[model samples]
Target: MLKPRMIEEKMLILLRQGKISKWFSGIGQEAISVGVTKAMQEDEYILPMHRNLGVFTSRNIPLYRLFSQWQGKASGFTKGRDRSFHFGTQEYKIVGMISHLGPQLGVADGIALAHKLKNEKKLSAVFTGEGGTSEGDFHEALNIAAVWDLPVLFCIENNGYGLSTPTIEQYRCKDLADRGPGYGIESHIIDGNNIIEVFEKISELAQSIRNEPRPILIEFKTFRMRGHEEASGTKYVPEELMEEWGDKDPIINFENYLLQEGILNEEKIKGFRKSIKKEIDENLHKAFSENIIESDTSQEIADVYETYDHQEIISKSNKENIRFVDAISQALKQSLERHYDLVFMGQDIADYGGVFKITEGFMGEFGKDRVRNTPICESAVVGTAMGLSIKGMKAMVEMQFSDFVSSGFNPIVNYLAKVKYRWDQKADVVIRMPCGGGVGAGPFHSQTNEAWFTKVPGLKVIYPAFPYDAKGLLNTAFNDPNPVLFFEHKALYRSVRQDVPVDYYTLPFGKSSRIKEGEQISIITYGAGVHWALDTLEEMNFAGADLLDLRSLQPLDLEGICASVNKTGKAIILTEDSLAGSFASEIAALISEHCFESLDAPVLRVGSLETPIPFAQTLEREYLPKERFKNKLQELIEY
Candidate 1:
């Protein structure tokens, strides 16, 4: 406890001297970090909040590397990508918190879920503050943890204030632990200032949880001795409250108790302080002298996705006619059989199958442990998939509809997408998104939201048009080390059928297939739009056109798109998304920029109307781009 306290004290001086950018002081709250961390087993994972600098120090992370992280040096854990305890280290079994306080709670549930599935007696511990209890993630995480009976120690540090807001304004309950009983979790409240009490209580709870594998909540009632950060001073706190808490400082009180017991004396304490100070000074000097990170586009791009050796999948002669949905189901079944560590999770996916019956009969084939059903908590389920991926298990999540992705957006875009670049952690998770319209399922159930994920870095976006492409791309998605968003068009689930290979195969991302070769114009599209373009071209008796299907959006077929445009010298990009900010616009922009000199006219784009998808069949038909695509292609051909 004193070691982290002394290191933080020196860090505070560095903050004052402008040697570091900022600091979130854990001055009076060191007991919670030190005690809780000490109580856990070394192999157990702990997700610490930003103020829990003591957790990092307690785990024996090198002072030079930590200081280097804070100083934004190249040798830091994040390679100068983030600051504070915002980065996680796989080596120390520490998953650090993001700026959003409550999300890590769900991640902790994920790690615990993995342990339980593997029949390991390991438990995970996660920390959050009193204010974080108000977040929806807090409720979702606790509910799922309780429902699944996962082994997780949820620690809440009730440090009197959330930034400047008092505890009175934060909640109506007497203590945060009071809400634990509502979730069917065992709850306890402890004196966070008393190091011995915190340690003993946490140790008992951890042991019980490990033995039985159930969720536990511990509320540590303590006070912050400094401002939220150095810049945000505690001026809003009453002077009387500050003075009262000042008298109860954990470090000073512990030192006095040790002295009274004759375990520590003035001379021995002085010597300990001298040695710690010397060590911190030398580390700070080394960290300060380290080279700063430089901007390298190639290196930055390389770090965005992990590299893997491509295995050429030989096409077998065995083929059978299958629907698009069947191809997806076959790919998932094959993946589950091949990878023993893969887990498939979604609402009603186990026994009831799924809303679309995509996973029908999966539970009987794979068992409940592998084909698991989840609550209606999208955020927690996504975070759990990420946690499973972090533990070397592959995870597949099914979004009933792409619209509900908004609820799980933070984990996918913030955590799963950024984990690799931030901490070199690969999240091998695939989120199956059933998107697009034509079945009159209304706005919420039908949407082509592929553009939302294509703009996000460190994510693979696959939108296949036919059954063959769907199965092949899915195989590649399951094998990739990065997070992938597999978009399956709802209308094409059963409407599209083709003779797909029964044997396993994989297709490379960023590669496009040319459906037909022509010279008059180039038609670029994907997903359902591919079928629309094919029908339109055949209906109009237009044979002089180059038709290209972009199977993946993020690792897009830029070279193929440019090549087609250069050959035809005229292009029309089509999509099911809205015209404004649609992916079609991006393709058009790329064509104009890369193949401008070879163009015969201005590039064209076709997309849905800029309005929410309506429930009425007529309204949806008028909104989609299928009718408008013919005119756009004609306009491009004439030009």
Candidate 2:
């Protein structure tokens, strides 16, 4: 009864004191949180949403740390880079908490799947608000969880509003819990205001879900007495909402139950409130007055981000490396052979071998138990990877097309990206994405958006054009301590295949490969589009178009790029992604800043024009930097 009020009071205090910049409230929504947490085992895993402050506190996220995070203190989780609402403690087995509405469901599924595969007893519980239940990701997560029968408990806190949109407007269904049974999951609706009822119901549901190896959904019928956060207001809320829900306030209702059940006397209850208020006030002050950390933390953070460097030749057959896809296929083959803790998942990745056929023969090599095929739910695929990655397994997921990468954006950024850095945990995860624009594949299928991932710190972005590079990069990603998104150019999958080295070796990330060097112009690029830039140089009769393959995009070889620019005196940056704020933009800026005086023609940029890439095959080439390439030789000769 006191958990929600105390936390809300603390949040309000911190907000007014300017100690907490952001805080989500579960004031009237407490019983459900406290109930589920009470039902969950001390060591079982949980992925919480922002509103479940009571659950988090029970899970051992100290109020001060949470408060300090909200206050934007340096000591906060995410090194103060993340939001106050994002609270997690790996030591306590709270996998993570994300601000994204329903994505955690997928994350939980992944972990449960991994745990079950490894024969571990741990289960995963994910919490989300009523509003978040309607997303495609929500349905995706539930479907996978049911199919796998992963021991996961999904608790929905139906506070009636998905922000300002009411439940009636959000879904046509009468009960969110009812939808779970359709997915072969057991479910129940609980009176969230009644702590005893909630606790018992949650325990029963959690046991069933965990024991059956299937999921169970608990629709927590609660009300929000406070606003969404300390930042937002209740102005949009109707008067009748406040009036009708007043009787359903968990705190007030729970307190009455405690009194009726003789669990607490009036005087003792009053004393408890007073004590909680004082504790909250003191905690807020402490959270504010705590010491700060400086910027050198990332160096140590980077230092700690090391895994056991495990690179070994599994078989001559495994790695007399062949095609780019061969490296992927062999890597999966070797990964499956070497470690039973590995799982391969994605759309068409099982038997059909993915849309690019990258996972060909995987179903035969590793049976359904290990190499699982998924529905076309990229968000679910990645989210499940997050879960498995948490449970001490290496999960290699395939995103059918790089363009569809946006579907699982939340898990990639919030769950997969931040898990290790934020909670001091590990996510040995890799996402294989077929990327780049070329071969007249049209706009939807062809787009290189690695730049969207490049700016994201902690994630390693690998783009390999040849079979050898693919083999090396896959090794690097598998060995990497953090999450890695390995971008395989679909055009290059069958288009190019160099006989790779027999030895198990890895090309270090952030290094550039110079295919050829020339003095006239340095054609700096990555992926399949770079091939065109190279071809253009020859077609235009430029004797010197220095082609440097940017194999690693995130840890860009600035020194290499600088050296090339200094030698060539002219440069042209080409990329197939959108023109604005693209990788080309970054490279151009880097050259201008470092090798500015050496520039001959304002550093020519050959990239897709600043517009949505059109669908027509002929128009696609036209949209790219043809003039920069067409006039390359002429421009160089003039220079």
Candidate 3:
């Protein structure tokens, strides 16, 4: 406790000196971090918040490396890509917290779920502030953890203020732990300032959790002695309250007790402080001398996604015609059979098979452990997948509809998308999105939101039009060590059919398939737009057209797109998403930039009207780009 307190004090000095970028001081609340971390086993993972510097120190992370991390040096855990405790280190068995405080709780639940699935006697501990308890992720994580009886220590460091807001405004309950009973979880409240009390209680609870494998919520009642961050001063805090909490300082109280008990003397304390100061100074000096990270676009791009050796997939002589939905089910079954660590999770996916019946008999075939049903908690479920990925297990999450992705957006865009680039952690999770319109599902259920994910880095967006591509690309997505959003069009689930290979086959991403070839114009599209373009060309008997289906959007087939565009000299990009800020616009920009000299006419784009999809069939037709695409193609050919 004293060691981390001293380290934090030194960091503050460095922060004021402009040596380090920022610091979240855990000065008065050291006992909670120190005590909880010390109680956990070396192998048990702990997901820590920014203020929990003692957790890292207690876990024995090298002082030099941590100093380097704060200094944004090349030797840092995140290679200087992230700052403060915004990065995680797998080597130390510590998953660092993202800026969003509540999400890590769900991540902790995932790690615990992995342990339970492996039948291991391990548990995961996660920290959050009292204010973070208000987030929906908090309730979702607690509820899911209780439902699954996962081995997790849900630690809430109830520091009096959340930024500037006091506990009075944060919650209605007297204590944060009181809410645990509502989730059917065992709850406790402890004196976070007392190191001995915090240590003994946490140790007991952790052991019980490992033995019983259930979630427990423990609130460490403490106060933050410093501001939220170094820059945010404590002027908002009342002087009396600060003085009262300052008098109850954990380190001073512990020191006083040690002195009275003859465990430490003034001279011994001074010597200890002197030794710690020297250690911190030496490590800081070393960190200061370390080279700053230099920008390398090539290396930065390479690090965004993990590389995989593409292998040619051999197909069996026998093939069977199947619906797009069946192809997806077959792919998942094959993947589950191949990878023991792979787990499938979604709402009503177990016995119910799923809303689209994608996993019809998955539970009976793979058992409940592999094929699991989750509550309607998108944030927690997505976060759990991330945690499982961190544990070296692959997870498949089915968002019932792509529209609901907004609920799970934080974990997907913030954590899973940036995990590999931040700390070289592979987020081996695939989100199955049943998207698109033409059905009467309306705007809430049917949305072509692939462009939203495609714009984000560190995410693979796969939108397949055919059953073969759906199955083949899914296999590729499962094999890739990154997060993939596999968009399955709900409208084409039953309408589309193809003689897919009976044997397991993989397709490489960033490769486009030429459905038909011509020289006059190129019709480039993906997802439902591919079908519309094919029909339009066939209807017009347009022999002078090139039809291309881009299977993957992130690792996009730029070479294939440029080849067709350069050959045809005229192209039309079509998509189901709206025109403004559409992926079609991005494709047009790329074509114009790469094929300017080859172009005989300006590249045209066809997309849905900038309006929410309606329920009526006629209105939906008008809203989509099907008819517009045909007209646009003819206009391009004429031009």
* Highest lDDT model number: 3
Full ranking by TM-score: 3, 1, 2
Report the error of model 3 at residue 504, Å: 0.8
**Candidate 2 structure quality by residue, lDDT tens digits, 553-617:** 87789999999999988887877776788888889989999999877777866666777666687
**Per-residue lDDT of 1-639 in model 1, one digit per residue for the tens?**
778889888888888899899999898899999999999998899999978988988899989999999998877889888898889888999998888777788889889989999999999999999999999889899999999999999999999999999999999998899999999999999989989899998998898998999999999989987898889999999999999988888889989999999999999999988988898889889999988789898988898887766674856759999999999998899888888999999989999989888899999999998999998989988888988887889999999898899999998999999999898999899999999988899989998898888899999899999999899889888888889999999999999999999988888888999998999899999999999999999999999989999988989989999989999898988899997888888888888889999998988889999999999999999999998999888887777
TM-score of 3: 0.99
Candidate numbers, best lDDT first, in rank order: 3, 1, 2
- After superposing candidate 2 on the true structure, give the runs of residues whose Cα lies further than 4 Å from its correct spot: 17-19, 230-244, 251-263, 266-285, 292-321, 418-427, 533-545, 608-630
* TM-score for each candidate, following the candidate numbering: 0.98, 0.89, 0.99
RMSD, one per candidate, in order: 1.1, 3.4, 1.0
What's the lDDT for candidate 2? 0.76
lDDT of 3 by residue, 455-525 (tens): 88999999999999999999988998899999999989999999999889999988999999999998899
> Which residue pairs collide in model 2, if any?
19-71, 110-384, 110-387, 110-388, 111-387, 111-388, 149-213, 348-354
Give all candidates' CA lDDT scores.
0.90, 0.76, 0.92
